[model samples]
Target: MKQKKPNILFIMTDQLRGDCLGIAGHPDVKTPYLDTLAAKGVLFSNAYSACPSCIPARAALHTGMLPEHHRRVGYQDGIAWRYEHTLAGELSRAGYYTQCVGKMHVHPLRNYLGFHNVELHDGYLHYARYGSVPYRESQHVADDYYYWLKEQKGISADPMESGLDCNSWVARPFPYEEKYHPTNWVTDRSIDFLRRRDPDQPFFLMASYLRPHPPFDAPAYYFDLYKDKKLTPPYVGDWEDTKLLKERGRIFDSLTGPEDEELIRQAQIGYYACITHLDHQIGRLLMALTEHELQNDTMIFFTADHGEELCDHHHFRKSLPYQGSIHIPLIISGNPELTGFAPHSVCDEVTELCDIMPTLLDIAGADIPDRVDGKSLLAFADGEGREYLHGEHSYGELSNHYIVTKKDKFCWFSTSGTEHYFVLEEDPHELHDRIEDPACRERIAYLRNCLIRELTGRPEGFTDGTSLIAGREYPVYLAEK
Candidate 1:
């Protein structure tokens, strides 16, 4: 007799910060269910999204490759994805029923890529929603969630009734029933999938949530949890020049200048509320798994595509190299009876979003391709991993590259050749920059060389033979063949 393969529940949230969980010691954000899940499994404190945006970060995630290999270095929309080996494709090949429940965000909008079926709900993509194309023939195809909302709340129902921009820093309570919210709708459809799935074969279900990402529209009850509390203010680095950053002009999807303290507080309240609401939905999903007697044989993983800035360093969105914009939460939990299982443990190894592919394949007894740039974290307890992780993104005027190790972080702005360094052990909030300190000059030079080497031979001409060049045009996609 052979052992039964375990089912996999891959849960992903969008733009959720790594430190927003109660287990991560967030000052006000309460995620009791996630805290319980972390206690029952392994938590990676240093996990990050290399590109720190929806398209590129998800490219790294599904392909198990870095931005350079995946060729999505920035927040690009409508480029066709042509990866040969994807997480869902490999799992489907290995006899698992792979399905995705939200936010595929792929070109053509309905492209399934590898998942056998995708119930997508990509919230408010401006390019797709308001492009020059016609409504019926363009990417404006109605998503499952939107249709469901109309069925439940009538055709005039709109998530924008709260009067908040989807990607802005403004915050407000959702203007509809809690059950009608997109977050709950995602979980609802996910539970429906589990109830209707084939019982004999092991499954790989991706419950992807798009909340906590923007519009900041959580339910009023969830918002009330933090409305009266004194939330922690965003970190202000000593080297940050707000005036200069504002002078760069307001880019799309970002707020310019310093926001008022009250507005910032409301934003934090709404952001945290969204997280908590999503956490509650997670609790419901876990309950459904147990109700179906699948909890004991399911391996659950929770993470996000990237993190939100929430006014950190005077920034409001992603595409920056700051910790608030790149760092993400990764929790792996499930049956302790499984192989190589460890309970209530935390792994601080530097991990990236790409690592998720190999990790899942390793658990499912599938073959990982040689082209993968990410390593399986299944053996994380043995202390075998990279010494440092490299990350970069094209942020228009703020294009930058970075290398993060356990002890420190180094950042380089390609537009101006400006460098910033932080000793992680001493300054966790990154309020101080050590680039100019005489004692740290050698380390800075070493990290700079490492970054330069990583950027060498790219199509953007970001680097020469000896050093990184300044003022290169930001590369959003790979040069045509």
Candidate 2:
């Protein structure tokens, strides 16, 4: 008799920091269900999103390639996702029933990227919500969540009633009931998929959530969970440059935090509440899996597109070189025998979103495509990993490239050629700059040379093969071939 192929549940969240999980020793946030899941399986302490923004990060996950290979080194919306092979496409071809329950932030807004089906709710994308866009592509017309919300309440219902911008740090409790919240709606639709899935074939279900991203309108119950608690001060780095970093850092008013302490408090409360609410909804999925007797046969992986700065050093959003923007939580829990690790074990190997597709492909007994640049993460259990990983984003004046090893990180700005180095093992919060430290001088030079080599021959004119060039035109998208 043949063994059954395992069902994979890839649970992804938006803008959730790596340190936000209780299993990761987050001092304030409460994620009881995720903590229990991490305790039962493997936790990747150093997992990252190489291109730490929405489009590029998701490209890496779907294509199993690095940002350069995917030709989307930054967050540029509407560019065609032209990858010939994708995770969902490969899995569906491998005789599995692949279904994406929520949030496929692809170009064309409805591009399947190879999934057999997609039930999407991208959560208030500005590109789709624009007044000039075609009505067929508008959020209200295309977003299932928006359409459903209007059905539940009336044509006049809107998520914007709470008065928050999608990219702003402002936060508020959802005016509607918890059942009507997008977080619960995503889980609701996901559970419905499980009930209707084809039992004859194994499945690949992406349970993607848009909370912990922005407009932090979690239900009031969740907001109350953290609103009264003492706000933990965000990490403030001594090297923060208030003058030039507003383009890269400040998501709020100041480079340290917002001028309005009440607003900052609300942002923190709302952000943490979104995460806790996501955790509980995941618990509901776990319960559903067990009730269906599919718990043992299912493999689960949890992670995020990128980490929210959450006012770290006054940086409120992502696309920065800081840990608060790049580092993300990664927890894989299911069957110990299939995952190849002892329960409660943690792996510190430098991993990134690119590794996800190949890892899942390897686990599912599918053939990984030749375009994949990432290695299977299961190799980490056997003590296999690269010495370092390269990450970058093209943000014009503040555009930056970085090299992060397990122990440290080095960043270089494209416009000014300014360099910064940090010994991550010694300074986890990145509170101090070690660039001037004589002992780190040699290491910094080596890392800079590594960056120069990584950028060599790129059309962006970032490097001339021998050294980096400043004032070069940094492009957010690849040139037409």
Candidate 3:
């Protein structure tokens, strides 16, 4: 008999930094299980989120399209997702049963898009929480995780009882039992899906977790693991304006600002705790897969929507053009019996979340859509990848654009017309900006012209004939699409 096609397990996390894993050489964060998986497969060391925010990043992932193509250039809530082709939809058409266990972040709260079934758990979204239009249905209906939490704990049980803002830098241990945490709940439902899935047909399961993103509420043991360890301080760039420290310091959810040392450490502890907790749950999922004798027939892909700044360059969140905000981890592993499987390898190609859909479809022997902007990473595992990646986000007054290659990066601030360049080979942490270096002036001009070409025809009119115009309010979503 012909061999059955391999199962696909696409694991995703929210706001997880690229370098926080032990395999990525993180000094303090411990991700032993993820490291082991990386050792057994191919790890894309230079993966990035083009838009570096929740909504746009996920748009790129689902549609295999660029931010510009998808028309979600920045963070916008309550917009209807009207895409015709999606990763799950295409896979379902290819004879696979696709199911999403965690966050989908699709509008309408129940927009399954292409997934046969989606048990959503989108963490604290202001648009849905405030009973905004188009999301009023969400306000009336609780997510699967929230309803389950109410059943496990009382109706008043909340993850915020620990006194931490969902998106703020505050930190604390979870107020309830470890199993009652959302991370474990996500894993629990995922395992239950595995136990109850249709066994005759191959399955495509997306185990998406929403932790290490906010509330920073890991259980006590996980939090205690990092509370007393000497931690690395956030990098402070020489060109960063310290004035931002004072200007936005007191704002609870300000994107960029200086935070006290103790508070930063506490936040780091909580963040790392959440990662470890998530890692442990991932271990459980892997064990369950093995217990079901599905390990050798399953292809697993692990990644995140984007990275967190975590006070890097005095920035506390994503949506910046820095490595801390855009860079993310991508690891793909599967049975050695699988075709094109590269064991114990690291691919240093420039990859993005957009590549996910095509890559998975490629593995499943399905046809890739003609309109996708992303190429299949499976074909580039041992070969060259994109020459450079363009990333941008509309951050109200701080809208920005960036172009990044393997060795360097160029950033442009649309509000102030300021330029910043960094040589990644010499300064991977982006401690120094070299835009003023005479030796690099020509390269800077080249990158600036590239950025101009990218934005020249956009609806915002961010670029004129030759130069980028400043002070224009960039729209969250393009109107002319």
Q: Give me the candidate number with maximum TM-score.
A: 3
Error of 1 at 277 (Å): 0.7
Query: Each model's TM-score?
Result: 0.96, 0.96, 0.97
Q: Pick the winner on lDDT between candidates 1 and 3.
A: 3
Native-referenced Cα lDDT, model 1: 0.86
Q: Write the per-residue lDDT of candidate 1 for residues 52-85, one digit (tens) a residue.
A: 9999999998999999999999988878888889
Clashing pairs in 3: none
Pairing residues by index, what is the TM-score of model 2?
Answer: 0.96
lDDT of 3 by residue, 1-481 (tens): 2336778999999999999999999999999889888988988898999999999999999999999999999998878999979999999998899999888887777889899999878877777776445433563364788777877787653456677777888888888888888899889999998999887888999999998899899999998899889999998889888777778866767776445778778878888999999999999999999998788889999999999999898888899999989999999988644525568788888999999999989888899999899989877755758988989999976789999988899998888888899999799899999999999999988888888888888888888859889888788898746
Worst 10 residues of 3 by lDDT: 131-140
lDDT of 3: 0.87
Name the runs in model 3 displaced over 4 angstroms.
Answer: 1-3, 132-136, 336-341
* Ten-residue stretch with the least lDDT total in model 1: 248-257
Task: State how far residue 372 of model 1 sits from its true place (Å).
Answer: 1.3
Q: Which structure is stronger by TM-score: 1 or 3?
A: 3
